[model samples]
Target chain A: MFSWILLSDKKVHQAVADTVHAVTDSSAHAVAEHGAHGGDENLFTQLLHHIYDSKYLEIPFYHNPDPNKHGFELMQFEKWYGIDFSITKHVFFMWLASAVLILVLSWVARKNLKNRVPKGFGNLVEVFVVFVRDEIVLPNMGKGGLKYLPYLLTNFFFILVMNLLGLIPYGASATGNVSVTAGLAIIAFIMIQLSAIRAQGFGHYLAHLTGGVHWALWPIMIPIEVLGLFTKPFALCIRLFANMTGGHIVILALIGLIFVFKSLAVAPVSVTFALGIYMLELFVAFLQAYIFTMLTSLFMGLGMQMESHGHRH
Target chain B: MKNEENNAAGMIRSVAPYLTLGIQIAAAVVLFLFVGKYADDVLGTKPWLMVAGIVVGFAGGMIHFFREVVALSNKEEHERITKN
Candidate 1:
């Protein structure tokens, strides 16, 4: 236990030193470029550079000899119109997360269970699955929500793993990307709509949007109801994206303090605070993942249960 | 220590569902505000449409919010009663 503690302590020191080195070098570059880009523009550009998606894959333990160059260069694709469809850092991380999930989950799935729990990682996976079902899915969605379990489970794990990936060295958080969260929210929106349609039938679903009000009030109610439908998913997209990215920004800023002061004394204070935030971030990661899954189910439940529970607005 | 952590987590779990309610209310106004801006641009109306959007969106959002609260509370009460 002592050796393990010592080893981990050493690892943390190394990681923190490496991070400081990386940040200082980048800030140096940013400071150099500030003359050209305008001073204020480059102030947070170094911090933003780490958060924003890029065309390079930052590999851990593989340092570039040249200070100006870093990471393996990804494929550069020509833009079609103003939008570039080229593979970026976030996309690479997302694919890596998905591949890891598929491999590990399939391995867990193939495990035989006969009146006994599987060991190690399988057990951990089972805990999350059961937690999602009982605490998240079944609570809001109920027994009828079993059909949607697979998707909810996938969503929970995907977000959890992606959030965790961001905490690691040379790791980019795909969930921090607004577009990715928006895509997930879009899927959740479609699922919510589909759940309502399945529960209430297509005719009742249309009527529900009219809010069961008199025909005279239909015009006003329809637009409001439609907007409400979209607002939920839009909020979801922003919430996840903001929370994931915001934590990273705070951590980056906290570390950036060391460089900003140009003193070793600042390092102790900044590193300690950064470590505290990093621990809090670990909690936030799980919390955000849980919140996302919980809200998705809650929204779907609101739709599915309306037939039986709702007073038709 | 573990129980304390779980309790804190439970508190968060309970509070989280309602976070969306605030967002819904805010989003309604923002969504409509943008819609109104677009409409004003297209139809040659100025700030009037945007002002209308805020009023309409607020009222509409409030109604939706109250309905959701009632529905959710009703379910909770119903579940509590049935469980007993």
Candidate 2:
């Protein structure tokens, strides 16, 4: 009786193994037939493709015969004027952010004109505007910074909107792209240099490049000073890009844990962690926007003050 | 109270730039090294120019770093003195 029972248990175990093996083989064959280039893509690569910008945008409305293949059949434009001027999802998102900014700010302005005291959405926006003007601009740029109020305010709001929008389901963060952040940083850089030139005159601005070093040290000091000018904006670009990308990557990775283990048991834990990360990302979206704007204002203030000091000396 | 508040704000402002100091130094060095390497290729000086480039880039980056630190300290000191 003991031998018979042991044989029955062995037969049951073999049946389960055979079923699992057959299912796996069929799935693998189906995936190969569908022509998904990255066959049975592991969790990490899937997560990467989700977060990172791709050449073609996936269309939800379209259905491909092979479900394994991405519905990435969107038309791609060719190069323009010797540059790869292809429009990607990130570019569309940037344009969307800009359009939203214009519409919202205009509505707020119109509302403010009719009412002395802000109400509803206008009130909330006014609070941000006042904060940027008072806390960021006034403290850093002083009274003279008022002229730059529009520029700085635009930067803050635009970045904040872009960051917040990224947190929305199916929305990509434009600022997460290095190219976009670099573009913003370059604008800030130009403004800083321009402000310095305007404050100290052309000759004085050039003279300031000497970094107060003796003439003999100009060769070394000049290159370093010039490098300093670029490094500020470069840092600005990297900081914004890294911060935005880091949060999304973390959230995606956490969600990816469920698939990596290939077990339903991991879902509860993975999803819980992902939710926590998503909340942190929401906070980071605001914090990063504030930091980027504050740093830009501070850089402007520094340049203007340095030029003024040179004049005084 | 206002003086204390100002001091706190001043501290934040001064400390902010140091966040990027390491990156700045690295970028400066890398940028110079590349330029040096390119020049060496054109001028046929090879290793010598590249070495010189590394030295110059490093020294320049350090100088800029020190200058920024000094500037921040000076600003902080000036703020303190004016407040007092």
Candidate 3:
């Protein structure tokens, strides 16, 4: 058994090193292991706890194995409808992300009172604003999308910040949580439906659910279409959750390679590869935020376009 | 309110088709399969209905897939021709 592991060590390392698999679907195994690995408080389990939402914030420059001694516990906030409502680290990080953005937008970003042009941070902020306006909102959604720009812009920056939080020291990524992503998806879904309803009217919206099919097939078609309506945002929720989670999985798996081999020789190589994956995680942070925003606008556009153009290819 | 990444999104616009196509294909099958499973639970046919659901779902999913592929290819070809 040890001989096989030794022989295939380099080969398995190559597989984990590829990281494309790790960056995508393989992250699920990382999450699935959370349930399967309840016994030991090994490295993988610790990594899972760090990535997963918990009731306490991990304090900087501190390490504690005992659950009770570790981090500032927000504890349970409230319980409604059988679900435990707790203000955990993920929630704290999300709020922190929002607060930081709020400060940047409100006070620190305003350096252009005297000059016509926005200077420094404000200028940097302007570039993104114009880019989103001209490139994303106008192109995909057109003038009609201008009304929804505030929501779309908030969606973009909020998600971008949340994605970035995980990369920073002692910060948890709220977007990695399915529940957080689901909440965002739900808002996006509402906006998409609102776009369709506003453009097409109430009666047309209901009629469209029939899929222009005969009344006899309405039972099948309506349910299918409604499910289809949900699946778009559902796709958004799952993609963000999985991509972020997958990144964590790849990192854990690479770190796990050392424990698997039980060798000090693997440490340098494993750490190097883990560092590379970390860089990729940074790119993914932005990519995911972009994908979510672009897709949301595209869906909103498609919603309005459905009626005006009569069909989409 | 701040710099978002619509500009970057333009650079990666081509990536969208790749993401959506698989989901479109799978979604049809999954949704149909779900309806079939619910029906099976009520009707007590268990495996038989689920088996039928799988077949139907695959057929339905494939049709959607082919149609989407054709449309995408046609659009791509049109763009290639028009670019020249």
Candidate 4:
């Protein structure tokens, strides 16, 4: 089923590309007829023409003009059963990250589970797992946080892998896409609400939405509380996506300076800056993954904390 | 000794919420402004509903923001007392 979808998506992409090319070609012809002859084309006109003729940069989530021409291209389905089932680059990377995580973790688990002392890669994985459980999940969620270890651990590693993978030469960061981040945030949000409901019971959970205010003030308080729910996840989504996308944009823009100047003199400076940004991006990749996971765990913990159970104002 | 270790861990965990607070406040206000605008368009009330949206959104966002700040302060105070 997946293979068939992939095949059909490829066909759809081809059709879309063909359509774009045809439209551009017609426009170019119109311009030629109305404005500039081949020899008489001005520098600006020539530049515009070049831009038009140049294949669009093959970003992961976007449509590419040529699938065979290398770089990342999404298999566009256009529309499949009233929904677009196009397999984009981000989706592919997400799947790859999941597969890689499962394989690595399962191997680590097999090795470490049987041994009193793990060595090498298993040791490394153990260190991260322990750090997350002790420092992030346990501290935030208190004594009850142990039950949430699996979810938080999985989240941290998945995000870490996805972020790190983007630093690779040809890999795109799935988390850089708003939709992917939003999806993760939604899951976190649901977990948070579930934790709250479980801890406080349904009545108390709904009561807390009044924020301990008088019953008469509920109309005003309710909207604010509800907004609070969504704003947290929305912020989470934006924070991850923006951090990832911002770093890439900076690196790309710095590199584009070389082409813009069209001079070898600028190449060294541009490359140097781009390289620096790329290195910073690697640090940021890990930082963002850590931040996202930490925040999600904290939010979950907060939800589980009874309003009256915490320190009184 | 374990409590001391947990205290340090708690300190670290506390940092994430502050990082997100500003963004949350701004998003809340902006979201409500849009919501208000949409409501005005749908209801044909023009400026009144839009004005009400801006007021309500700002008030709610600020209230939430201040509440979080207070909660954080209180938690910090409690932690300091316990540590002492």
Candidate 5:
């Protein structure tokens, strides 16, 4: 008796194979060709020559091992999503960065609280907090900007965490994934559009979409402007995605250099680029987060500004 | 003198609006090219979608930039009227 497996270079291939083998109480070898039967790599291909198929077990991260328990084994995303999204590793990094940021900031916030004077780390963070509030959010968003501060702050910190996490050796960058960044951009897009409609009535917001052109130009401009709405958020998605991915790829390639050259001597030179890129990535982590938050504020601000000014009549 | 203030403000109004748009456009193009390089590895269909995505992205950026221009002018006019 034997077990069967699917052979593909896909990431889940191993997991699927292991599952099949664990279930079947049989020993099977992967076959490249079918027997005289004109069958392909279907269900009955190679593993059917078995008696029983038992369930495969995995080492748990931490578990009580039951579905009703706090931590269970079958939460494997690879099994469920069928795509190796590396979500756990990414989440681990995200949590690490968040934990660090919170501890440090909270310590500073606690230490710096004063009746009159601010000092040290508190002073430093205040500078950024104020800068983001004044330079980033206020100018674009206007007075209503105050309302969006919590969201803007959350965006800033979350992205800052994700970006910084990518710099760590074992950490996966969550923002490097298109889905994560896309989800963020969509949130920004919806907030901007919804607020625009609320601030300006639906009629005015729709008119804004037409770019205030003669009705003739409206035909072309409206579609373009509507496209623009999606494009800004889409650009937001790609910017964070590419920046994070690019840094990681560069670092990976630099490290790969030693392997490619097959020489220990190349290690020193490769280390230089790797270190350099990593440092740049550190700055980029902060910059990208700032840029994303700043742009979101700017868009939301513009919409609100238009609504207020347009209604002043 | 007040007119000069208005001119400077108007100038700022003109330049500031374009500033963000230009940056966004440039950024989008750079990112499009960067992702396009890895399209085959990610999407499994090679240069076709990547090339198309790049073209579409560039057009989108340019169009958005133009729209911002019109919007800015409209905004400036409204601000001027409100001042009066």
Candidate 6:
């Protein structure tokens, strides 16, 4: 049973095994001195706690139980980030995804740099990189946006990688977390504002608060425009966070239907919906990356235009 | 009444930018205040750091707003010169 559960991911199991060995070492010493092998009990109990109760367990959010076994169980968020944030399961997955992305991208990047025709994975990555730079970054952001292309490219690919990671069986999605999306949105917001400031001088930037209207109309229009700017990024954060989380929740709910109905009869129905949603999520993953990059570029263009106007008169 | 309407229209047009400025200032202030208040309560800070946060956020927002306006003006000037 333990070995089967650990089969979900080998590294996770090894890490758990290491932790299990560490905790059971002192206890194992006492148990061994007694000339009994019952230390297995202590090991088992520790493993169970780690699996079910410990913060370190990375249980799949969408789990369905067999009717042959004891019923269904819902994955709990409170158990993960709340009282048990120390659990390295989510953190480990995040690190693993990031490392794998960096290693793979770098490897592909180096191999394709020769002055010859690129093929295979190198070709795919190059096409993606160029498309984002030319299509997404350049058009919306205008010519001046080239300076910020690297950041936008990293953001898009990083998000794309993380989103695709969750699509892998048993892999957890980091992008589903509000904190992660909010952090990304906040960074984009900082970039947007800084670019604006850099283009326009100190005095003129504040003057934009009034929508570049003459002084007499400053009272009413300023607040609305200001709110508009802040709300744009706030909406971006919420949209990404909500969409990612909502998909996972729907999948979980669908699986739970079989357990609720107490029959395998629902499996056929549930699987169809699950597959359909799974496909939709793949598209959504790309759509979100595109939207975020496009918006950032658009904001950059607007800022540049504002800056150029500021110096005119 | 007609005079007041014209004044309101003129005010609407001119004060628009300042109003936006105030809003940007206010949003930054409110965001800081909300976060500071939450943190102070959660972290057990005495006297609540929200007041200081609001002041700091407002000042920062003003700086940001001024910078944006200047950038816009500069871009406009470049465009005009190119057109000529």
Model 5, span A1-313: residue lDDT tens: 1123222323223343344235321121121112212233342424322111112222223435464432222223455466564334445555676787789878877877753467777887778878778767776677777888878887888898888765653345778877778899999999889878878889998777766656865544555566557767787889998988877677655654443333345657987887899899999999999889877877787677776565321
Candidate 3 chain B minimal-lDDT segment of 10 residues: B1-10
Question: In model 2 chain A, which range of ten residues has the least summed lDDT?
Answer: A26-35
RMSD of each: 7.1, 6.6, 8.3, 11.1, 14.3, 14.6
Worst 10 residues of 3 chain A by lDDT: A26-35
After the best TM-score superposition of candidate 3, give how far the Cα of residue A69 lies from its true spot, in angstroms.
3.5
Ranking by DockQ: 2, 4, 1, 3, 5, 6
TM-score of chain B of 6: 0.66
lDDT of 4 at A97: 97
- TM-scores, all candidates, are 0.80, 0.83, 0.75, 0.75, 0.60, 0.59
User: Candidate 5 docking category?
Assistant: incorrect
Task: Write model 3 residue lDDT over A214-284, tens digit each, in one string.
Answer: 68756555655676678789999999999999997787678666545544467579879988999999999
lDDT of 4 by residue, A155-201 (tens): 99999999987777546678878888999999989988988888778
Question: After superposition, which runs of candidate 5 have C-alpha atoms over 4 Å from their true positions?
Answer: A1-74, A77-87, A95-116, A210-222, A308-313, B1-84
Go through the candidates in order and give each one's C-alpha lDDT.
Answer: 0.77, 0.74, 0.73, 0.70, 0.63, 0.61
Candidate 2 docking band: medium
Give the native contact fraction of candidate 2: 0.52
Best by TM-score: 2
Model 2, A3: alpha-carbon shift in Å? 26
Colliding pairs, model 4: none
lDDT of 2 by residue, A1-313 (tens): 3453244433533433344335322221222222233333554555556556655544434445666555454447788888877677788778889999999899999999899998999999999999899888888888999999999888998898889878875578989999999999999999989877877788888877887777887887787678778878888899999999999888766654533443335557877897898899999998888888898888888778876554322
The segments of candidate 4 whose C-alpha lies over 4 angstroms from its true place after superposition are: A1-75, A307-313, B1-12, B15-39, B60-83
Instruction: Report the error of model 2 at residue A96, Å.
Output: 1.1
The sequence of per-residue lDDT tens digits that candidate 4 reaches over residues B1-84 is: 245435644565556558667765666677778888999999999988878877877777787778778977878687688768
TM-score leaderboard ranking: 2, 1, 3, 4, 5, 6
